[model samples]
Target: MADMQKALRARILGAGIVPRVIWGRKVPQGTALPYLQLFAVSDPRPGHLKGYNGGRTTRVQADCKAESYAEAKAMSDALVPLLAAPATVDGIKFGHTKAEGPQDLGEDTAAGFVHRMSLDLLVWHSSV
Candidate 1:
């Protein structure tokens, strides 16, 4: 099966909506504001019954981080509809994404107290 997490990361970055979308939680030093951190909360094969992807459900946490709360929230606001739209990538046919956030995670003081808006996504997809 195609790697859904990688595909989602590529798609988001390719959208050019944000300056950067890192594949993991940890951001590198000296990165700019209004960036994204992508994390896979879970990736489970829901069933063996056949289709494009075998009915996989990918739970992901996509956090928008910035120097201020508004910037973080704005970045995430721009992403919600895009992620929720239906599409296909790298043999992974995506269905609508169910999101549970833009939840304020306050700030990460360790990371310069960057304000974070977190988007938890439940994605339905299949790898054809």
Candidate 2:
């Protein structure tokens, strides 16, 4: 099975909207403005019959951070379409992505303004 989280990070980075894309619980120290941070919320395998292959649905939160709300919104706006487009990342075929935000996360004392988006992606890949 592919590491879906890494695949997601690659996809976003390849989009070229931001210079920095981090995939982990904590953002990198001294990171510049206009970067993306992705964290996996959950990955649950659905029920399947015998001898059947089942894929996992992953829920992820993508945070676009910048010095201001406008910049964060712009980054997020560009991100949505990129994620929505159909493509395969690191051999992981993406079935689809459902987005739930561009929600204003307000000011971050350390990182400045933050805008968040949630994505529920249907990932289909062979089981290991």
Candidate 3:
């Protein structure tokens, strides 16, 4: 749901690592450095056929951008732990979140060096 995504964004922002966080796409033009870009790639509902009630698995991507690779990796390091733990955000009870790849993207002419990480979250809510 949209609320889940918003909550996730809020959680990322609350970490206080990056100053800017944008969803659905990359940072906007004229945005400052040391920003984060979040994307909700997929949400597969009814995670399991046996328990086809109120659970879903979402694949999310968090891209950390900075002037240098070290900064980018540091930001990502902070983020990985936050996402890995189970937490409740905006009424959505998120279970364990598994992450993969601080895949080095090397550099970007516009966005600077990038480190992209993928997170798979198991989320569930009673009213869903």
Candidate 4:
């Protein structure tokens, strides 16, 4: 298990994604452990309308852990540039999750952590 974790971390770091490995916590029944989460913002190109990835991707999160901050930052940096150009992907908005509290906020709250990232990228990319 340790070796496998190391290998996965290496791959993620090599890929240049903002990798964050958080310990798993217990959840309700049927819940899985060690769920890894990933997020990425994307821009929608003109051609994407015909495909499944229609609009600009604001955020993409998956159920998995990343190795470190370098890896996760790398992924975010790689994606930041692409968003300014043009492309389509299947990603969620910053606050698309069902979680309450910090995850969910009212309009006046001014985008929280997740939304801030998404909105900032969107604004930057849109300006370009």
Ranking by TM-score: 1, 2, 3, 4
Per-residue lDDT for 121 in model 2? 38
Number of backbone collisions per candidate: 3, 0, 0, 16
* Alpha-carbon RMSD, candidate 1: 2.6
TM-scores for every candidate against the unseen true structure: 0.84, 0.80, 0.80, 0.25
- Model 4 earns a TM-score of 0.25
Q: Where does model 4 exceed 4 Å of error? A: 1-65, 88-120, 123-128
lDDT of 4 by residue, 25-92 (tens): 43234332222333333334434455543322232333331233343343444444433443212221
Candidate 2: worst-modelled 10 consecutive residues by lDDT? 119-128
Judging by TM-score, tell me the better candidate of 1 and 3.
Answer: 1
Query: Pick by TM-score: which candidate is best?
Result: 1
lDDT of each: 0.81, 0.68, 0.70, 0.31
Candidate 4: worst-modelled 10 consecutive residues by lDDT? 97-106
Best by lDDT, which number?
A: 1
Candidates, ranked, lDDT = 1, 3, 2, 4
- The sequence of per-residue lDDT tens digits that candidate 3 reaches over residues 1-128 is 77887787787788798787788774577876678777778777764657666757777777777777788888888887787777777777777677777787656565444444333333333333
lDDT of 1 by residue, 27-98 (tens): 787788888998888887654456343667778888888888888888888888888898988777788998
